[model samples]
Target: MGAHRTSLTAQLFRRMPVGRRPQTEGGLKRTIGLVQLVGFGVGATVGTGIFFVLTEAVPVAGPGVVVSFVIAAVTAGLTALCYAELAGSVPVSGSSYSYAYATLGEVVAMVVAACLLLEYGVSASAVAVGWSEYLNQLLDNLFGVRIPHALSYAPEADGVVNLPAMVLVALCAMLLIRGASESATVNTIMVGIKVGVLILFIAIAATGWNSDNLSDFAPFGVAGIQAASATIFFSYIGLDAVSTAGDEVKDPARTMPRAIILSLIIVSTLYVAVAVTAVAAQPWEDFEGQQAGLAQILEDVTGSTWPSTVLAAGAVISIFSITLVVMYGQTRILFTMGRDRMLPPIFARVNPRTLTPIPNTIIVAVVVAVIAGLVPLNWLLDTVSIGTLVAFMVVSLGVIILRRRAPDLERSFKVPLYPVLPLLSIAACLYVISGLALVTWIVFLIWVAVVLAFYFAYGFRRSTLRQDVDDEEVAP
Candidate 1:
């Protein structure tokens, strides 16, 4: 029994092979650079939550939501640095899951995979739901007809189903099935539209800024600020998406770190600007249960519908892209796990014509669509935040472990301040995670438990690497 257990431990701790060189012989094409890297980071980071999170956060923190944004940014920035180091070293597609697998062990990788699945699936669904709200707002503006509340929201929002959100997910899935690609150029255009609309909101909202709104800042005290910080943390979830491209990024040693820092600064600044301008334009108390909060603020400021219309239209387009990107991330993560035999082989199967993971994409789309149709947006957002915070902490720890375990490994990017930055990253993630509601934590724990149970029941016995090990021992 002791020998058996030892063998299992060795198998679990085996590191995945590092792919340090570009695969030029019929492999993935490397074509992105620093500018495109920053673009990707900014585009992924500035979606969905910013469009609707104030409705859920403002009542808790009042005007202090700006402070909340800063708190979340600090934590996310720290983790992005850690992510940069690991991503530059590993240069794999699974993001945190890949990092953990390389540094920790197979079981830990499975756990990280569960966390990532939560992050991507919930983030995509939350973004889709946000898109649904904006789509309704845009239709109202353009055609003077709106999707009825009954078909536009989940049960928590006192509606039958969020049909529009489900429809959005279904549409994105079809696009994925047809091998839709968001090239660097296309991503840049989407990023421009998103940033342009946000800038327009700030410019208009700044015009109506009043100093009185600042007076009641921190009305709910430190605890409230922390709670709101945890909620808004969802806004910064995609910053690591930048680091994931390290494999293809040019001069990754210098470019990866710079892009991560610059993009975080840009994203955080925009978020703070939006929060400050929003609170200044209207009392924070009025934000609760507000649909299309940003657009509504603009309408209230100018007493005209034109600015709101434009903002709504921009959100509709940009958030649709976000949904697609996050869903693609989800599918790819599952494909990696399936390839490892941690999941059924079907998830790893790709269509020869499209060269995409069709079954994996379908499964992800179905799950996200169901959640978008049934669950409330705020619930999905908080759940996503919790999972992402945990994953970020894991990645930070992985950086430290890899540094200690493989001191001779070639690393393009390394975290500065040695253990200090990675330690701070872990601490910051934990502190913010503490601010989440008990219910969110409970739900997260239950979800993770379910994934682990599935892994033990199926993954342990069927892992391809384990099978290969057994076959080798038995031969000759």
Candidate 2:
């Protein structure tokens, strides 16, 4: 046990060499500005989930789900502030993985990387599954024919492969492989489509709103509200993607901070508006077993399928973009791990032609595709929530650590209320976590242990940081 403990410590705490860090491949141009950054965060964040989350959250809190949305936005707001500071300080692509490495030790970074794999990778799969649902809805409305449930859902549900989801992942992977960049212009266009759809939804649904529907607020009580908050949290996951692009942003000190806050406010406001409209237009209890809930709401109100079809088509396009951005984030984090020699070196290798980590992207794409095609949406959502919450907790703690340890570091943004805000963030995270099932927690722990095991078995000896230290000792 003593030897095992030693080995574990050695592996997980492995370090990186400052000299070996890869140069910016292809001398990639830094063309992103504040507008572009805001667009990326907004585009990557506001889709599929918000359209569907209302169906789940409203029943839990009734009309009180609006308050729950407020709670979630506040928590996400605090975390985004912390992320802005770290991103400005580190200015790297790996997001929290890069931040943790600079402030915490190597071992902690690996664990965070593992959490990210679940966060972005699995979440992409989840989004693709959502896209599949909307795509099927769009087809049925436009063509009066529906794909067989057996051909459209996972085999786990007594069906064959999810062909549409698999195709979506594969297409995204190809774009990524070809270095198809999601420039600020493209992101802004996508954001426009997303926002326009929601506005259309609200405008149409408002005609059907009846205040009586909100009278029985909190039908399920505090327990149900808390449960709903955990689910709603999924919609807030990509706010940090804004922070991850810190290295390339012009005047990051100012841009990084504003973009993060602005994006959060815009997204939260839209989400709450959508949720309120959906609930007011129809009874909250009827949201159960709803697929393409927002689009369905439109159909019910208009007594025609055109509005629903438009929303479904918009969802399909916007959700696809979200999956691509998220999947991109996942591969970059793994590349950072590989670069540090904490995982296989292959992950860090950038392709000479694409200047991206082609192999790593392929591996991530394949794994996520399998999960999307086979796994159930409910399982994917729960696992993603757990990973994201833990990672957010770490970022909040990192903010406190960096403030104390390196008080002189230039931070473009700082968390307001200091320790109070961070403490509140942590508490809210735990509150949401408390609602997760026992099985989810058990699965999370097992995944963490497996990551720690890999760190000890391989990362210890090959760590670039350790080798650099050894070389310094023998220098003439």
Candidate 3:
């Protein structure tokens, strides 16, 4: 029993071969391009944080919320560098999970995969719930009769079922099932629409700007800024979603890093500008519990219904793309896990016609839809933040490990300052993580423990590396 346990531990730490090209050479299609890849990153990110998070974050940081946006942007920027390097070097699906498997070992990779689930699937559900909120807002603007609270909200939020959120998830699932390139093409157009709408908002909101709003900046101090930044980190979820498409992009080595960097520049610039413009337009104290956030803000500033109606309509259209891209990322991650035998083989099977993982997409959509229907949106956001932050830190660490272990390995892209930048990335992620609530940390710990337990009991015996080890031992 002792020997058996020791051998299992060894197998759990076994690493996949470094520098593995994307399995798309034979499996998933290599059809996605640089432009669509950026759309995936930006689409998954923008609609979630800017649309509704101000209501939650402004209350904590006051007008200092603008600074919080910068804080989160800096953290994400540093981590994005690390991600670009690894995504270029490894060029595989699963994002940070694949990076860890190639460098840190199987156990760490498994933990990262669990984190990816929270980052992709749970965030997808939460964003869909936000979509429902804006969908109601758009309906109220157009027809004056909105969905009833009982039908549109989770039970915890005083509704019996979040029907609209589930419905949105279903729609996105349908798009994903058709094909990867088809979904990416639609997302690219939605991304353009949302970006234009936000630019319109900045222009209009800037006209109403007041200097008084800057007076209360940083009212809650550095701790508050850090805490709000931690929450806002959830906004950057889409940036890494770009990395997860390693298996589907046209040229993984050149396109992966370019898409990640380009998306970061676009997202961070918009995020900071929006934050500054918004705080200048209204008192931070008025942000809490504000529904139809940007739409309501527009009405407050312009004293007209037309601009508010436009914002709501834009949100309704763009948030759909958010759900589609995130669900796409989740399915790809699960498909990679299935290929490695961490999940069932059904998830690994691609449709011959679509060249996409149909079972994986269907399963993700069902689970995310259920979560959207049952859980309050705010309850799940912190979980998403922690999971993505931890995965990012893992990628930063993996860069150092891979460089040391495979010194001569070809890397198309490299972190500019090497150890300094990766170390800063790790420190930035940790600083933000420090601000997470105690319950969030507890939930994260319990979730990781559960995943690790399953690995020892199930993944250990079924791991491909374990099979290889058994074959070596039995050979003459």
All candidates' TM-scores?
0.93, 0.92, 0.97
- Against the reference, the lDDT scores of all candidates come to 0.82, 0.77, 0.89
| Each model's backbone clash number | 0, 1, 0
Model 3: per-residue Cα lDDT over 185-277, one tens digit each = 999999999999999889989998998988889888988888888889998999889988888898798899999999999999999888899
What shift in Å separates residue 462 of candidate 3 from its native position after superposition? 0.7
lDDT of 3 at 446: 92
Q: How many backbone clashes does candidate 2 have?
A: 1
Model 1 misplaced regions, further than 4 Å: 1-6, 20-37, 183-185, 243-259
Ranked by TM-score from best down, the candidates are: 3, 1, 2
Q: Over the stretch 1-476, how does candidate 2's per-residue lDDT look in tens digits?
A: 12223355553454332112434654223456888888878877898457666766676678778777777777787788788777666666677777777767788987887788788888889888878788889999999777788767888767787878888899878776765344456657777888998899999999999999999888888887777777778777778677666545677667877887888888888888887888889888788768898899999999999999999988987887788778777777777777777779888787776666788889998999999999877777777788888888888888888888788877767787898887888888898878877888898888888987887788766777766655665666
lDDT of 1 by residue, 360-449 (tens): 889999999999998888778888898899899999999888888888888878888989999999999889899998999899999889
Candidate 1: C-alpha lDDT: 0.82
What TM-score does candidate 1 reach? Answer: 0.93
Better structure of 1 and 3 per TM-score: 3
lDDT of 1 at 335: 71
Off by over 4 Å in 2: 1-29, 180-185, 247-254
